[model samples]
Target: MKLLMAAGIALSLACISAAEAPSNYETYYGGVRVDSDPRLLNHYNRVLAYCDREASLPQRGSPYPYDTWHILALRSCLYRYSFVDRGVHSYPANWFWGHVFEQ
Candidate 1:
């Protein structure tokens, strides 16, 4: 009985961790679905990194309020690559716009 209980606990723990694993794309800015192409993925990652750096800075006396600056910056960067918005906003499902790499 003790062994069975231990196994059950371990299994539950494993499931919990798996469920909490991070997705390949960022969840904060709606949902972005990047293509499997290496170039697109690299570009997406670079945009994310750049946006992250931009977001970390203080936004004192900025025209955009709160997190607007970050969102605008992200949109601007992603737009350069011709990312399309799917118009879904469910979040964690089909939310806001989707970004894809078009060659």
Candidate 2:
């Protein structure tokens, strides 16, 4: 029982350390779970913020129009999630079994 408890504790810690923020949800489709680097998340956030202002948006005829920043930010969030899943979480291929089995 002691050995079982110790193993459980160690595994739970590993899961906790690997878990990513709920907002970080980018890499779902490609079977690519990227554990996000917090540094990268900060960088993406700053980039999105700087481009959010009306004045910062590109002119109407420019490729970097108002919508550009919105789209980029959305993409960034997706990437953050994907990176987190891939790089941090050890959600094995058989995680569905846990859902079905674990109460």
Candidate 3:
């Protein structure tokens, strides 16, 4: 019975650690999970802020004129920022699975 209890405790700990582990995307995209690099993380946050500001700005031309362009530009900037910070060229292929399986 003692052995079984110890095993159960170990298993629970393992599950907790696994759940807390950073996802591949967080590590890959802009190093958000990187606690050691505050500078890079701050820059990533600044970029996101800038993107939000730009997206919220009103355009003067046609209705929704800059919507497509803004989205594309923001996406490009984010991808470039992530690549620069994390040195990862591609998004995690398993990102979807990670979220689905976690819950």
Listed in order, each prediction's TM-score against the native is 0.36, 0.25, 0.33
What pairs collide in candidate 3? none
Best by TM-score: 1
Segments of candidate 3 deviating more than 4 angstroms: 1-35, 57-76, 83-103
Model 3, span 1-103: residue lDDT tens: 9999999776543332111111222445444554446765566567766654554554511224235444444544555556232222222334556568889
Q: Which model, 1 or 3, shows the larger TM-score?
A: 1
Please give the range of 10 consecutive residues that has the lowest summed lDDT in model 2: 53-62
Each model's RMSD to truth, in Å? Answer: 14.8, 15.8, 16.5
| Winner of 2 and 3 under lDDT | 3
lDDT measured at residue 29 in model 2 versus the true structure, 0 to 100: 58
TM-score of 2: 0.25
Taking the candidates one at a time, how many backbone clashes does each contain?
3, 17, 0
For all candidates in order, the CA lDDT equals: 0.45, 0.43, 0.45
